[model samples]
Target: MTIPVKNTMDKKQAITAAIVVPLIICAAASVYFFVGSLEEEHEDNQTIVIVTIVPQQEFVEKVGGDKVRITVMVPPGASPHTYEPTPGIMKEVTKAEMYAKVGSGVEFENNLMEKIISNNRNMNIVDCSEGITKMGNDPHIWNSPVNAKIMVENICNGLVKIDPDNADYYTQNKDNYLEELDTLDKYIHHKLDGFSNRVFMTYHPSFGYFAKEYNLTQLAVEYGGKEPTPQVIQDSIDESTRYNLRYVFVAPQFAAEPCKTIARAIGGETASMDPLARNYTSNMKQIADSLALEFEE
Candidate 1:
């Protein structure tokens, strides 16, 4: 329709309208797809199952691949030592088809396994620590590579029993992963071989299993299943200094400040290690490397 209009103004308005109309339509379509995708993702998240406990959860995901859904029971950054289960956590355990337990001093001190069984009577609770050998029932069985292999096998077996159809899949995964574990064991031994009569101190006594495997001595700062008192701290500092220790091992989930203070007091440094790391191979490698660097110097 040719109406009287300011020539340049009319042309500019027409161009603007032409550009804006398609842009609005395209934006609306894009929003529709984005919302649809979100909805699909939400549904997928709902369908996936959850696993409790960090170590077990990690092992399950490794062996299960995309076939299994897992959620860790302990929240990240929470101390498993003092973590207490809530009603909501128990509900999750109840819904879980299987439960993977470490059955160590940490969980026992916190009283975790009883809570899971008390809540979920029907759910199969598999002790990944089964068949684990301890020099004297040392709770840190998961620390050693050989013991970790046993744990992975235990997890794979649990998965098979839970989902029988996937037995072969889990078995195949177990066989492949076991070789990597054996490699880790060899690497650890090789690194540790340089240090005979090597000794270190830790905040918690969680490294006994690791130390035992490598013939190293780990003297814990907190001895009586309690946090160190002033006297205990002083005594530990003295002991570490006496040995001319190079590194003081600290766990990620625990407060390293006290240990750092002790290390500084004794003119030594602190090394952070994860007692509850999910990746078995990576965790072992890190520990071995840290120890080698610290002890060799």
Candidate 2:
């Protein structure tokens, strides 16, 4: 029997849909792949850098701008003195072209440098603490804006070494960031000047460089990287009494109970500070402002 005209048209329409549907799908897939490839190329063009702390990430960004990607080995809220990297983190390190180490005896770097270098033999090591005078074994050099300036310069140089084509771009950003740090130094000095009680107590001695730079004293409850002993706690309390210190500072990465103990003994309270913070400029200002209030003898 001969097929009806309407039935023939329906069969033809069905055949057309089968052909058009797959063509539409293939076009969408091609676009998706093209966009994905562009994204991968963009990321591959950027230099990979590994740093030990959040502040170093900040320093690298200020100097490297959009030309660098940073991986921080010591994650946020973890103590660099005690942090151990996971297998995943070590894998990330293998992709890095540079490792910007604090190199001022930061415990994390001291313990992991040998292994990190072994993992990525091609990774160029950048000593962010280059040319800075270390305070004995103290590694909290980034607390002082002056030291931060030096660290930023080191980071800028490292970025330039790996990505020379962007050297001018990195240098411009570094100069601008250095000016900001210099301004920060002046701001801290203005906030802290003329305060009678320049002694600030902390649970950890994370502000030693800061105190040294500002001509203040950091009375730490913890001594020698150990939790406070009764004698160390008493010593901090006695120093607080002697210096008329009204606050004991506690960091995000440390135990606050020890600092609180001293604060309670002195009839004072504890304050918040983060030595390994990400927002370097604002964090340092907040620290200076906090200390200025307690410095009112």
Candidate 3:
């Protein structure tokens, strides 16, 4: 018994529908899963990190690579001694999974630590200055490459704690950055080697740690974090004369008038030096170069 042409056509259409419907459903399911996976990957790839200064931001970027989103509390040209965070910054802090504090008793940290902890109760707080030798309450621990090595170690530990899956990546990056820092240390030493004058002058006492590291003395025009008195200015002039210093280092965060005056009094020039610079290696090298210029025999 032969089937009619219409009957055969109906059977063929039914078979095609059965095969295509399942295939279309499978394709849609695959697409859904692919999109969901991409979203999950994107979420897993990034972490929100908070830092108190630009240098700390650099450290985080070095170790965290593309995995971190940094929010620096102390912007460039603003002294950490007097920085006040806005409500928006606090809101950003609340969203951060980690807060890498300078942790060396900077005035801003002293004032904002409580609020920062309150804002993000569960955020991991990493003290970047944990093992560094303090300079009589000096908070510029990152100034010394030796101290910076410790800070980077602390930063890496904090990163590993929060993101264990990426621990190896963080460790590798930390190692690489540390090697660079070591090279920086050696370069500074090489530049300042065999120098006649080991003393340098600055507007602010920002380079105490750097001075300590390189066996140099940093004389500041400012005293007790205050503007120079007439006597202090005279004293600085006398010291500059005595040391025969050729340059006075001025930072962008502070007024340069005092440094310029002292420099002029001693017939020297004022040079810009930023200890809070974001480019860690280059900043140190530049500082070394500036000091080298003054100390050239």
Candidate 4:
């Protein structure tokens, strides 16, 4: 009787395990697959953003976080002033939900905005320079942290427009970035506060807005976006000599022809300064530090 009872009990346990173990594993697998599918769907649904410049890429990424996939029209080591978006770059417009343009006379935007829209009329346009008073035709608006904050707000607004569900997330990221930019502005002010000579000479006049923000004068060896002519070089040398400026800044994208020549004439040296730098905050700090070196001396 005991043996028959034990055998019956063992059969019952085996049948339960055969049914319940498979059921539990199937349920767990279904949940895992469901969650994985949802994650894949979410990733597949990310908003496509096309930006005109490298810094715009940063601005959009900071605000958009994982909600947006960005394509920068002007790649690094390329000047937006003279860059044209290739057909391949324009193709991105087809999928883009938004286009964040450095709309302040950036040659790339000015040249291709219409074509970009033509490719995708549904694409929302976000002007990064929306709130700032543009310094004439200068496209270097993001050079100033104050202007950068405005750009970031504009970017956040665009992200919200494209992905309203994540508006709060975009807004929070923008707030954090704005705080960092404010700190950067204060740090630059503190670093350059007591400098008597507020003049900086560069190969390109890319820092006009930044110089204006910080009460500094930006002298350019490259005149009117062209390599400096003889007279322009002489004038730049004279200007730097007047301010006792010690360094002439040049970027990787532009020819340093007159920068070095002017530096030699003015008894200074040519140094690197990229206004279109992707690492905006750190680049600005580097700029401040470079200026501080010259100013401190």
Give the Cα lDDT of each candidate: 0.76, 0.90, 0.90, 0.86
Q: What lDDT, from 0 to 1, does candidate 4 have?
A: 0.86
Better of 1 and 4 by TM-score: 4
Per-residue CA lDDT of model 1 for 1-297, tens digit only, reads 346557877899999999999999999999999999997776554313344456556677667776766767776656666677667776776667777777555554347667667776776667777887656646667788788788888888878877888788889888888888889899998888978548888898888889888888888888545878889888889988788887788888777887988889988889988877777688889988888876775
Candidate 3 CA-lDDT value: 0.90
- Tens digit per residue, CA lDDT, model 2, 43-145: 9999999999998888988888888888999988999888999999999988999999998998888887999999999988999899999989899999989
Off by over 4 Å in 3: 1-44
Q: lDDT by residue for model 3 over 52-117, one digit each (tens)?
A: 999888899999998888999988889998889888998998889999999998999999899899
Residue 132 accuracy (lDDT) in model 2? 98
After best superposition, candidate 4 residue 288: deviation in angstroms? 0.7
Shift of residue 160 alpha carbon in model 1, Å = 1.1
What are the clashing pairs of model 3?
none
Q: What are the models' TM-scores?
A: 0.79, 0.94, 0.85, 0.85
Separately for all candidates shown, the number of backbone clashes (residues 3 or more apart, or on different chains) is 1, 0, 0, 0
User: Once model 2 is optimally superposed onto the true structure by TM-score, how far is the C-alpha of residue 227 displaced, in angstroms?
Assistant: 1.7
User: What shift in Å separates residue 136 of candidate 1 from its native position after superposition?
Assistant: 4.1
Better of 1 and 3 by TM-score: 3
